[model samples]
Target: MHYLLPARLDLQAHLSAWPPTEVPQFHPDALVRLLHLVTEVPAHNRKLAKQIRQQGGYVPLSAQLLQSIERHYNHYLTYAVRSGLLETDGRWWPTTAQVAGKCRGYRFTAAYCTPHPDASSDEVARQPRLQLVHLTDPKMQAKARRQGRRPTLLSPAERRDLRLREQPHAPLLEWLAPNRTPLRLDQAAALAYLAERFDMLPPVVAPRPKWPEWRPKWLKALDRDYYASPVEQYNQRLHSIVRLANRQLQPSIDTTVGRLHTTLTNMSSELRPFVYADGYGPLVSIDLVNSQPYLANLLWNPAFYTKSSSVKSTINFQNFRQSEIYKGRNVKGIIKEIPDIMLVNISQLTHREDIRLFSSFTGSGQFYELLLNAFRQRDVTLTTRKEVKELVFQVLFTRNGYYSPYKALFCLLFPTVDHIFRLLKQQDHTLLPRLLQALEAYLFLHVISRRVARTWPQVPLFTVHDSLVVPQEYAGQVEQIVREELRQATGIEPTLKHEQWSQAVRHDLLPPTSVASSIELNKKNR
Candidate 1:
């Protein structure tokens, strides 16, 4: 270790000569405003964005703060969700803060901005440039420290100082896809076909209100008549108690025990008063700390909400009809059905179909039909068995590395794409059973033909779900086969490929007929 030791005085002098580092633009008010937005008892993303937007006068917001705002809002929205601050059907919206300003932390007040009202050509000629003054107010710095936010934007010099401070960001890199696609499949066509063949999957079930109840005086409610409620928490908890009691009351010839909602009347004292959601239109709910259901936020439902085009939250409102609870106590005892075997099977299948279609496919129709349609237009010409194996390999372990993320080649080769992709995270292992199932099914009823099931000597083409990549000249032949096979498998008549898919499909195939009906968007699936 040969180092120069006598240079301390010179080093100190040199350091003293360096310019001061620039501070990021921070204001005391920003932190205060943000705290008000976020800690709003039950912080919400929409509410936060809205609040920011409401402060019409410019606030010094920055990109960093905006990002934090969205992040924290999401955090609190999740909180409100778990706390039952919202109803079972409640949704989140942005607070006013998110949209009002371009930068999240940078604010432009008349004082900070140039004196010129407008910066036009003449203003530019006047050399009217405004200089930014770094803030040094101790109070503002203290506020920034409390909120765990950076006091100002980091200039190059200040950023270097952060390095000196020993905090650093994670290294970022772009992991390449290696080979994405030279040819493409029509996911839209596939989804549409699937939706037609199989119905749209059922969404999550939520409890609704029962029929109207006689509004008793507020004092009378507290007094508790014999028929009055004793609070209970959660739908399932109430259900279990009611069901057990119903078993006790079972269609018997007792003196006087027709026990309708008997268990509901016996809830814990702390929970009974909040049981009435009938008067409230729609409320958002959160689950427990363990993700179990608990009531959350309640929003006033507008008569107009039911008509929105995109049925995100609107579906909750529309679902109120089938729900007996939504009808309230006045309509409770008219009639009910126990649900026989046929209905139960039908319901289970319908729900499963919904989940598969919704989760497996993105952007529309259904899952299975899309597969049939896409295969129809594809040219599956196979000279030998090698092509099939290659195709299968491409589908399964499509990525070059062991730890690579799931890729699109997944569409073609692997059958259990979902299972295989997900299982990568686990230490447990399994052979490609589901993939075997999918391939066996795909291979069983299918063959290369001019048209589907046409049984040509040469295997001309194959389909993987809804994607079909075939020669332009073979479009007509592929189209005919797709419709025939689709009908054969699903029992639904097939529509034109163009009608079923995105209009912007790079037509390697010839154009076909168009049908007037189908939602215009029902676009390409994933």
Candidate 2:
């Protein structure tokens, strides 16, 4: 009996020409479904609609995406467009063209539905209830099922799915809901300040240089996969952040990797200054310096993996190596020996000078700088810390078979560490990033956030991956706690950096000509 329908009426009556039994053209429910879809971006939420308007107010619609919902979607869409119920905008290009087919932006015509004017609280409450699209009719339900669509939202499972789509995950929902401990946002004030200055900053896309034949092979793959340039991607993310701010609702949250993904985390570093912790006033973010490399240092110790939530392998190293040897594996050849060779390497890990140096670099928060300096020494094309960091990530996260001269230099510098990285990726290339992210989530979410909440019940806490966001007043105490927890967990003193969330991005703070320069400038300013 449960169904989702548009809150307002479609005054155009676009499907009136078609009879109920019509075929190969418009169905009786065609207009209703199209209205349902066209209005789907805002979903009857006025705040969401206003926010979406900041991003040009169009919904990206593709024949491929629509066809996934039903087979005859094209005809239905064409009918709606010709009937003047819908209008098309320019083509929508996503980050990658391969992941999605051609998409055309679409929005509902004013003839389709009347816009609701801003009303007072009493007037809003007095408004009529949303009209429901009931599939109580057996024929309608059967037709929906035939199209591989949901027939009813009556079931508990269906309702649950709907709720999830409307709100955030359970734990994040509890934190965001209207309560004493609400995760508040001073969005109205923030957006007003941001809107005045955001458009002034021109997009600063980096120039794409032609790939030299002698360049690293992985660079080719990376460039090929990314359809848009760095600045274009940055602008895209910036617009999205602006749209998110316009909502003025509870910020959306994702519990992916056990981390809270709010608008704060999603926005560019340049835009971070405008947002605050609502009633608690201005906030500060304490970032874990060289988070990934620092976390990877833990992998050097065999005992860490057993205790890690993401990687809990208790296999005996000696037995594992013996088994590999017994299976006629080439034990003498390091690369061909075993994927779990890190286990065997742990015995002599402490003796390696390179391992000790790597630990020192990560601990002192100079991992990226160290790589940058080394790449510069080798006269590699990389110039900034950002480029060096990306190169290192590609090497660490990409498949072991991926060829790169930069990776070769890394191997030359830290033979033991590079060997461990190759061994870790032998089984699955994705294991490294996934394991590191999981460890990061455990460290920040389970360890730091939990400890902070337990100690200071009044302080509002949020997370941006490896970093922790709290009010400025409690920063020192929180920093101390973070330091203690990290050292206790990893047995290494980590370098932590703090950045305050301000109300504006100053003139000098404007993004520079290239992403690399912008990053370097931001680092220096921080």
Candidate 3:
């Protein structure tokens, strides 16, 4: 909620000259709020202090953000520029205009600005050096606007926004974790570790021109976004891990799918290696292989559709319409009207040979490798497990009409499975992902997490999606429980991978090893 302002700006004196009649949004408090929108980094994140040193003293605001801020008060930005708070490139785009490249926006006038291609070094240095001032007063925040309209009268977006902003965090479900005790962690020790790592990190630098040819190892596994710059990503990761280690933010679970989200989940996977839990050094995670595809494979089992079957209630599609995923999806009425048609389709597809093959591939964790080999046989360009894994998700979860060469290849390979997938999402594309996630959460959170907690009361438990992260000493025992429970429930012998949190590289990239292998390695070393 805090904002950034120029250190030299005399805010009280400046606001005293502006009469309420002449300027409304420029009132001292509102002006700071306006700056909040322009400042992309959070004040609580001290990474900004380092970012300022690395990326020159000024931070650039994108055109889209500037436009969003302008929507609130059109004249505020102009006032800031006139008052020597901000500097712009003198280019403006209409809301409807589609700029060919990234749209540039205003930056806070900094004491030492990065030299631009168009400006001389001396000119950039001579530009009045300004220091960023952190504004921390909660009184400066905009008061919540109360819409006098009834809940039924509000627009869907407004209601959703209101709910998200106002909703209080609820307790974890007993079925998921009977132990309602707070998660134990040595916060001071974790913070000390994180601070030391932060201090050791080199200054953040923009990627070189040949960045795509070769980049830092940490950059490899990151989800690619063309819109975000590398420098931005690095700074954000630094900020997130710092917040998490210090426990400034807490862990919470989503009620709809029973998925737990915490500070650990929010940070980059590459940074997770350095993090410890409950003072347990060098943790490891037991991850279900191809979790989504494996979950989807369960739907092919006829037992999954039977109410008497133990698995049915856990991932019952009958309850999906009531879930939050379909709140505004407009599929409830269609599902209600055609429940029989859905059952018929499921019954017919359950015993197909293609489905059996699909189930086999996913269950054994050979699905990605199978696809990669197939692509290679067909002389297609896909060469790695990661490439095929991405393609599998696109085929399974993307809209029915979305066309890609990989999707076409997948449909041709398993026409029956593809048809069943399309049929499941005919009413709503979201239904398929929701159903899969529900099953995953049930297996990991409810069955695996609950059992692990009861079996090893002293071992700290953490679930991140389809993985169970625990102390290295207990990884083998927990892995056995996870494997046994999943086999008993689904009748599939799932492939489980062990990832040591101490390793800089992902377990998949490293030589394949089990918790058993890790234990043996530790024994040999000892």
Candidate 4:
């Protein structure tokens, strides 16, 4: 069915044209490369054309690559269309850029283009086939290979230990998986509703704030590659949301694997708000305050840890008591009587000199600020509070432990992280990272997922590790549920924080008779 017919279509032969004129002859590989580049950015076709024209150095296209691209772009599109690899509505690529007319653009029918496997192996292949040939420059390929071979800082033993915990707990994974039949159907309906009204939705606001000049070098480097520009990142997120919505609306899960190929969990924070529930309003995110730190408080508490044989049971007990906050007088009395038990236990275990300061710092409900203050007190010359906080987390989460770049600065400035690391080492030298992952899994499976299933089954929910997102109207109820569920699961009451889109933003995005307005109108009518 392919239309581009030639007796022998040699991609290499057309790489360079004989007489370098304004219009360059097109090569199939060059066209494929152009498509791949445009697909990566997906902002504008002309912009991508411009980039290809201006590109220099190794693997530079024929001198007239831009002219060639513009001339034969339609031919390439026709080939892609005939090959069943792309679909477009004949509009310029839909982007957040405030350009006048629709720019011509195309989206991939699959995440990646590859040959279809035989029927025997078809069940294992989740991604659909694309006819386009994959192209990569030799230099870029070498660079990628070099990056892949770069030595990890982790010791051999630590690497082996991490591999054991890499596959999440089976029970946890099963619990987190979307319902096989019904959820798939519901997700489909919800996705369709959202997609139909997508244009009406408010433009996604830029979620990240301006970075300070003194941001951590590591953080800046990471962002430089993947998220060079916040606006571009925001645009990519918007596209991802639409793509996810499309996939979820259809059933894309692998029954044999019992997992979805696409999930809402990986979506950026900014896009979560746009995930509309079938009949509900916009989602409001509710999160546990200092979730990991709070869990650490319970895990390392001297009174609880010493008395309890099972860590899981102790966590359950804590959560149970937390659920009873303000409801049960006995629970309240117990908390009032031993309010500082967690703080005291952690302080003693860490051998921190300032127990009162630590308690006050934890009580202030600003975990990162506590790290910043501790670092400042130690005369660390960090450029910003954010830097200190990021440095501390980088140290704590690093599997390579002290080998991490931020280790020295963090260990010297904040004793708490060092204490936690040392304590985990005493338990088992290779257990620190695994323990952290396990704790996170426990919170997600036992606390958040369970609570959502039991209490808010009717309300659509999405998670971002420690936080939960639900409709804005249900924020108060969901907050209380989260607090109680966490208390029941961990025996500690954690402060919660929430953010919502403004009513104006919501109104602009949502239909006039959307759930938000309908609920308000109904209340007024009553």
Model 1 segments more than 4 A misplaced: 1-349, 352-441, 444-471, 483-526
The models' CA-based lDDT, in order, is 0.26, 0.55, 0.55, 0.43
Clashing pairs in 2: none
TM-score of 2: 0.57
Order of quality (lDDT): 2, 3, 4, 1
TM for every model, in the order presented, reads 0.17, 0.57, 0.57, 0.47
lDDT of 3 at 389: 74
Model 4 residue 221 CA deviation (Å) reads: 11
Tens-digit per-residue lDDT, 142-257, candidate 2: 56545432222124643453444322233323343333333333444444544454455444433333333333444554333222233233333434343343331234322223
lDDT of 4 by residue, 1-526 (tens): 0111111223344333322132245445445544443433322222343332222101122224334334565566565545544544454434356854434444444333221221133221111211223335565444333432332223465345444432322223332333321111122333343444444544433322244332333344423322122223333444344334333222121211112223444455444444554345455668666665666555444434443534333253344334321222222333333324334445254456543344345445686777676666777665566675566565555444346445676556545646555655553343444444444544654455565555545455555556765656667766776777556544455678886632223343443334565366436534
Full-model lDDT, candidate 4 = 0.43
Model 1 C-alpha lDDT per residue in residues 1-526, reported as the tens digit of each score: 0011111113223224532122134332332333232222111122332333233222223336545533344333233234322111222234575553233221222222222222233211010111111224566445433443222222455345334321111100000011211122232343233334223322222222211121122224312221111111122223322222222111110111111112222233222222211111111111011000000000111221233423233122233223222232211121121112212222233234333442333212232244334333464333343333333333333332333122333334333433333343233122222222222222122221223323221212222223332333334545555555433332234343321212333343323423211122122110
Scored against the true structure, residue 160 in model 1 reaches a CA lDDT of: 53
Winner on TM-score (1 vs 2): 2
Better of 1 and 4 by TM-score: 4
* Alpha carbon lDDT at 146, candidate 1: 44
